[model samples]
Target chain A: MSTIFAHGGQLAHGVLLTMLMTVLGFGCALVAGVVLAVFHISPVPPLHRLAVGYVAVFRNIPLLVWLVLFVFGLPEIGLLYPLFGTVTAAMALYWAAFICEAVRSGIRTVPPGQIEAARALGFGFSQLLRHLVLPQAVRSMVQPLGTVFIALTLNTSLAAAVGVRELTGETQFFTITYDIPIPAFAVTTAIYVLITLAGGLLTGRLERKLAFKR
Target chain B: MNTGASTLFDLPGPAGRRRIRIATVVSLLLIVVAVVAVVRRLTTHGMLAADEWRVFTQWPTIRFLLGGVWATVLVTVVAMAIALPAGALVALVRLSRARVARALGRAYVEVFRAIPLLLLLYMFLFGLPRLGLTFPVFWQLTLAIVLNNAAVFAEILRAGILAVERGQSEAASSLGMTYWQAMWLVVIPQAVRKVVPALVGQSVRLLKDSSLGYVVSYLELLHQSQVLGEYYHTVLPTYLVAAVVYIAINITLSRFAHLLENRGLRGVRRRRHPESTALAENAAIGSGGRAPLIDDSTV
Candidate 1:
């Protein structure tokens, strides 16, 4: 294990990729979720329906379905990302549905009186959403959204199915190459466990801080 | 997770309604254009052909897939069987009086919950050969799924346990019951009832996750779909079929769970609310378990 780490073996690289994918996928989920949530709550009936339909389809379909479909179907639509990119993109889309739900619910936590006040002050739709609604919505969202993103951390390993040499793939590759399956698996598993524990703790702390500020 | 009666602004006036109508038309146009682009290409490739779907009725393919469904169900049943009880025990350990027991229980839940189910599956399936205990694909996959879910179940059960009023336990102890007696006879049963919806959600997750067994060559429903693809030289059709199967099974499972939950809810005589703890539990535990595609809380 020490030698593998010292030489930056496949397992090490895989662990690195896993964390990278989590951060990247999580960022995409956040942005896409905010967009979808905005459309969902927008006064425009068609835009709201479109967003609702988006969440319905994406959320109903399993991540595996999107991963497989994007791999096989994207080129037909004239989108051509590599295996890793496709997997990450699909994950972001899948997670965005859940994030949209969290964000929508968070927006609900913003009192109706607040919206009325903003309207009375002549705040436009965009201005009200940007200046008034989003700030408070985000605060309520911090904990639930944190939990969802932490789940994203584990789902990153699913990328390995489409031939991304993330942690799981790396674990298999290193195990095969070094003929040290037990140690390789043990080490990679431990790293993920530690990361998950840390994420949960960090989110809890963040939630507390947000609560205190409120 | 379930957003109730929420709107961004007041109902639109006449002018506002006109804008909304225009926005609807524009959104529909965009969606139609995108859908057409994809459909046109698929038609060009013969992917939309009725002939490709006839294989769904073929005995060889259907039987193979049916076998896969059984495999998926078997995995779910076995994992749930072990994980549920084991999770409860772990929850007890988490709430144990002993510091070491609590720490060890916490470590177990944290570790298993953190690791991806697929990676854990790989670790057990591939790594076990090095430990002189290679399991059949079934056992290996089951072990991974059970371990992964048990940690999460433990946490959920722990929360449910905590949610039970402390006074109940106090009353039990004051009545000359031992701590174990109070927990066994009083606390656990109530906790389980309160969290039935969450447990049901987890069970469905175990079913869906069993599809991951395909990676290890478990010949589960997803793998059988791949087998159909291999023979037919068509990937999307086979995958779509598999997804349909998964969706159907999950829908049924959740429906049954809801039925059971409704009966329980009625007996408990809880106040009826549109948004139950079920959705909230689904969202929170789903962060750790499987996500429901449609809002199950609507049931």
Candidate 2:
């Protein structure tokens, strides 16, 4: 226990960094994902195709591969960024595909009758989306978006591969220094579990509050 | 085509078609510009040089990477094989009447699900060696993957089991079947069928996790690329090739999952027409709402 406490400051810092990366990654993903999703469903043929290709490429590759590629490949092209920025960018790019799909699926959940009702009521594309589709879709989107965020948070642990010194990386240092790998990792694992559980609880409450009850 | 109905919009009018045509042209130009710019950057950096990529044409490099692919498949298959039965057992335990058994099973699932696979990989790679129970690197990676995926599979299987109509099991009990017999004969098989797509999705995840083999010196596909990158001094291109390979494999897996999902929908259609013979039972088996995978927690 003393061994664990001795690294309290490091653990705390690691947690902060982990949260920082999650927030940053999710922020970028939200913007990019929403844009890509708009492109996906829009009438513009080329943009829709572009969105399809983007999602396919990003979704099918592993997050670690993207990180390694960005970390190493970008520097080769003289586009050097800090390790934190590089890892966050890779994560955002990878997860944007998931968020885009979630948003598209969320839109799908809007009843066909509602869409037909709007169309019959003489609403244009923009008006129908603004008044009917988005309101319902965004509500349904909260749960899936929340799931993506949790997965993103779990993925921040991969930042340790690029030497971000986040929770996992800090745990690695503590384990080596103290020669107590199990206890060190156990503590790290507990911290991660707490983060995800808290996320789950919060998302559940928000979903209940926002549910589209008749 | 049903695509017109399936999308958010109706078929476009003349004005809408003209607008779409113009937008398509402009976007096409923009995409072309972006692609050209990226290619130019690569060319300038000599990143696309023929000499740099020549390493891949050699038979030895292909063989090496193939070995890595084989290692990755071996790990994924072994981990999945162990996880399926272990997860079913855990699901059964969680579904048990005893409160202690349920609580223990829930704890196992929750703990494992919340933890990152990488952290677990590290624990297996480094922590276990300290306890005088060191295994080979491949086993180390495989065991970590098994522990994590078994928890996820347990959740998925449990959802499938619960999604089953309660009446089926009750009828089995009324027919003088023991609890275990009812579960084995009536419940578990249907549960497995209902969640086969979700299970395939989990397999995609496990295959991805096998890339963590890089961390433990396991020489899986990703690690092999790293080694090739070092040897050829073509880090970017080698890793890019490996990334493409990963993408191709995973896309094929996801496509298979999609095929299974569509086949279930076809079963639904056959039920609607009532001309279905064996498909009536398939429709019944596939009728439940999709089972919740670990990442898709509505529970």
Candidate 3:
């Protein structure tokens, strides 16, 4: 316990980095994911196929493999980014595929009747999307997106693999240096639990606020 | 179910058809251009050098990598064997009438689910040795994965158990069955069947996670590829091949889950909202665990 308190500053930095990565990664994922979802459901056939292929390829691969590839392999082709930037980008690219699916699923929740009603009212494609589909779809998406965010937060630990010194890395440092594995791990686990609990609560609140009323 | 694209847009009139056709062609051309540029860049960097890939054709190299695949499968199989039954037990405990049991179960699932698998693996790999409690490297990786995945499987199984209609267990009780007997005989089997697709989906995650064996020097596929790449001095190409291999195996598993869903084997409760149902499937697909449970609060 003393060991944990002694390293409180390091742990705090780890938590901050992990949070930064999750937020940045999720932001990138959101933009790419929404675009992919639109392309997936767009009237354009080839773009739909491209989106399908993109999700399949990215979603199927492991996050660690993607990170290693980006961190180590990309330099062979002259595309170099900082270690932190590269890992976050890899995470964003990988998770964007999942977010695309979540968004697509959210869109599907907008009932066929609602869509038909919009068509009957002579709404154009863009207007239907803006006025009817996206609003409700975005509402339904909140919970799932929250789930994705939590998962991303946990995954940010993998950034430690490429030398990000996130929560997991800091925990390792404490354990090795102080020879207090139990205290080190327990403190880190508690911090992670707190992070996830906070995320879940915030998401539940947002989900309720955004929920569509009949 | 309706195809999402078709539902999003009206059936094309002649003008719409023409527009779609032009859009398709334009998108195809853009994709082709992107591909060409990527290929050109790789060529310029000598990344596409034929000799770098030639190792794949050799029987010895192929055999070596297959050994890695076998090791990965072995780890995944052993971990799954332990995790599946353990997860069921955890799920049953969470469903127990005793509040203490439920809390303990929830704590187990929530903690493991919250902690990343790599951190757990590191604890096993590095921490336990200091306590003079070392297992073989294989058990270290496999057990770490089991700890995390058992919690996940518990959540998936709990979802299935809850999805089973309440009346089924009530009927079993009316027939003079004990609560445990009803759960074991009537409820659990049906629950397992309902969530088999989700279970398969989780297995894909397990299989991909087995690749983390690379971190512990377990000589899994990625590790083997890394060694091979070092031997041939073609690290990027080797990792790409390994990535392709991981993608191929996971894609097959994911497709199986989709097949099960499409065959109407998802669960007993038919979700009224298409978004809810889709999110459920996406939960299995996307997240580590926490698969949009019957009651989301439990997570």
Clashing residue pairs in all predictions, respectively, total 0, 0, 0
Better of 1 and 3 by DockQ: 3
> Poorest 10 consecutive residues of model 3 chain B by lDDT?
B288-297
Residue B38, candidate 2: alpha-carbon lDDT: 94
Estimate TM-scores for all models: 0.87, 0.93, 0.91
* Ranking of models by DockQ: 2, 3, 1
- Rate residue B205 of model 3 by lDDT: 76
**lDDT tens digits by residue: candidate 1, B1-299:** 22322445656789888987888888889989998987898788787889877888889878888998899889989999999999999999999999999999988887788878988878777777767888888998898899988887898789878978899899999999999999999899778876666677678767867878768888888777777777887678788778777777876787777766657656544654535446434434433223333222111
Q: Poorest 10 consecutive residues of model 2 chain A by lDDT?
A: A102-111
Q: Interface RMSD (C-alpha) of each candidate?
A: 4.8, 2.5, 2.8
Q: State residue B259's C-alpha deviation in candidate 3, in Å.
A: 6.0
Over A1-214, each residue of candidate 1 has an lDDT whose tens digit, in order, gives: 6756764666667878988889889999999998998788776666778787787666555676678778864564456787877888889998998898878767877877888888888888779889987787778787768777777888888888778998888877877777777777778778887787787778778767767352
Best-matching candidate per DockQ: 2
TM-score of 3: 0.91
Give the clashing residue pairs of candidate 1, or none.
Answer: none
| Docking outcome class, model 3 | medium
Clash pairs, model 3 backbone: none
The worst-scoring run of ten residues by lDDT in candidate 3 chain A lies at A101-110
